[model samples]
Target: MNRRLYRGLREAILEGAIAADTRLPASRDLAAELGIARNTVVHVYSQLLAEGYTRSRQGNGTFVNASLPDSFLSSGRRARLAAAPQPRPALSPRGAAIVDGASASPYQWGAFMPGVPDLTEFPHRKFGRIVSALWRNPPPDLLTYAHGGGLPALREALAQHLALTRSIDCDPEQIIITEGSHQAIDLASRILGDPGEVAWVEDPGYWGARTVLQANGLRIRHLPVDEEGMQVPQEAGGEPPRFIFVTPSHQYPLGPVMSLARRRQLLAVARRHGSWIIEDDYDSEFRFSGRPIASLLGLEPDAPVIYMGTFSKTLYPGLRVGYLVLPRPLVAAFQAAHAELYREGHQMTHAALAAFIADGHYAAHIRRMRMLYGRRRAMLVNLIERRLGADWLHRDASLAGLHLVLTLPPDMDDLRVVEEARARGVLTRPLSRYYADPALRRPGLLLGFACVPEQDIARKFEVLLDSLAEVARKPARAARA
Candidate 1:
């Protein structure tokens, strides 16, 4: 009986039926359940432990050893392991496409990694104090699921902040808190668009939005973006898009603030086509230029625009807090959809964020970071100019945002340069990867300076310059050959 029980348990463990570290049934419990003597179960457990199959913790039950030695298993169990490796489950068509076309970098936070904020500088102590205080005397609703768009206090606080800073015209009722801009985009795409519907995305735009919109079954049209912002197509293609996605305030990677005239043109286009515009106002808070650029939603009252903003860039990315300022007409629909789709929670954090904004910590932090990032940006730009020269690296005229685009020769392969830079501990994103069409792709590098320290910028950038020099030498050597 002991031998039979030991073989069964070992086979179960070896076959992966019982996963590693899974606690086994107590000897007494198993003895009673299986109608076996307690002495038999004890002997089996002792034998298993002696053979390195299980571990007995002091005062705790026996658990399967996480690391199983190949030779420790009996011959009978070894026979089962000799079979061919099982094939992985096949993904759906959409899932397969998403995995194949994924562009997310393995490293998110590093020197010169774009779109990441300086998390080290975050006021964790102050935020912790707020969290601790909330936990001490937490509200009933705070511990429960969020009702109605989100916490009223947070929406009101955000509404006031947006109005003062971005000139957005919105009431607290119009605001809907989201997990992040990604979720906000997903909700907007599904609620506003149907499968096979058209959606216009800015060429060399945010890849994340494109991925989310495409995943929701929207056909994406890449609209060209220049100094003025996303250009409105001269002639209507097959059908007007259900929505158009734009990064109007501090355009992603490129950093072009949408011109007032361009904003009006986009609004006009949206009205003509009866299309909803998703204005992704990412990283607009850290502008180092003139007065803050007004949002497209605020430009024209009742414009068909769904404004999305995230605290990822402003605060820490892990906060998972973002919002959507919807038009009054669409508020009810969005709120209903948000509840149905996301089933939002995180009330405690929402309340804490509201207090943070109300107490003026949010604005104060932004102000301090803006000054620090400005110095870091200037330092990187100076280093690039001094080391690589203006002829080799042409820095784009951008005064806002965390990252800057450095244009290279048209023939240069930015992707190759990016890979070479990565080997030297400098992270960079190639500009060509952002474009939907290969023909329109430009060779450029998106160098992020916000997260990197002002002092470290020169050293890390010098490493990048070395990679650039090597890339430049390759073309010359090939030409001689």
Candidate 2:
């Protein structure tokens, strides 16, 4: 009863129904009028007075406040403020560019949404047990800001694991734990290269890398990716790029493994120009075909490469754990820079992850997902090949990773196709969005297979096909009309 009375008065005051300085009826009078108990009315009146909606006089009845508090501003007040001229919020040139060219989708998970792994198949029980045990009696160090790069246990586990799996033999001290691959890229971009220095980025590369580099004021020079991966020219005709960014294991969007010859040539060219290569080993775990290859960083004893890898695909992304394997010469500096720039933490999560890896749960989970993803990938490829023909598929579509690029004819717009598919309750990304240069943008769709179930993949792909058919008919129907 008091709650109802309180709410009614509050609404009346906010809506301007009860004008300023209007006297509120006395508790006894209002209670009698409303056929309610006097105590309830008194309680409601007292609340309003305490809340600044009303003011009490020593001998007189309560009156509405002349000015409402800022915190008390209601929909009526908000509407008035909206009618006034508001200044645009200021942002720097780099900030403006980042916001304007943002490529992130609001929809993160669903059928054909690229770069996502199946969360349904994750080994949550094993991970949860480890995390729950840690929280029962957490150490003081786990709660504080992480110093000296990251958790020692996690780094040690990662060092051993990377050595055995990827042939990246390094001391635990050389590994710097990061929030994700995005942060790792940001740290490398800011620490390794300076503003205005040229950065050779792959055309149709990861947009996150481009955003971070651009934010750091590095001038990007797009290098075309081929079947053999990023082509390294015989000579640098003009100013040489200070940093060379490549996805060596499996090229993004296009999905080409860098040929060994091209890899050696790139290393030699980079050394000649005094350039550093930033190798992003993204989605390298779930290679669908053949034996998994060794990392580019492990090829030489002291390669001038900053290697980055993430557990986002292998583990769930919400874990927010990634690592940078630095060369011995860079170990100390990068460790210091990471601590200063990011102020890393999450030692508890790091501890849990370390235990998870050490106990072989991580390995077992990856193996299981790899087989599951391979099956889903096969089904998706079959559907696309049967409906659209094998010619429409990207050459390296089946080699590695979660997504495959379905190439479109030159006249068709990939963005329009994406929109049409999105309208049909399906999410897919346009491959053209990955390229920095508008002219170099190719028409293709990056459809993810790992996230979608085998049964659901066909259903979603059917809806996706209707989108393509509708988009294809658009030009022909317009011509006749």
> Which 10 successive residues of model 2 have the least lDDT summed?
68-77
Task: State the lDDT of candidate 2 residue by residue for 1-481, as single tens digits.
Answer: 8898898999888788998899999889999999999999988988888888899998898999988764456666788888978789999898899999998899989999999999988888888999999999999879999888899999999999998889998999999999999999889888888999989889989888889988999999988888988978878768898889999888987998998999989888888999999999988898877988788899877788889999999987887899999988888888889989989899999999999999999999999999999899889889989999998898765478989899998888788889999988999999888987778888899998889988898899999999988889898448447
| TM-score, predicted candidate 1 vs. hidden true structure | 0.83
Best by TM-score: 2
Clashing pairs in 2: none
Highest lDDT model number: 2
lDDT of 2 at 370: 90
Q: Candidate 1: which stretches are off by over 4 Å?
A: 1-80, 391-396, 475-481
TM-score of each: 0.83, 0.88
The CA lDDT at 192 in model 2 is 86
TM-score quality measure for candidate 2: 0.88
Q: What lDDT score goes with residue 426 in model 1?
A: 88
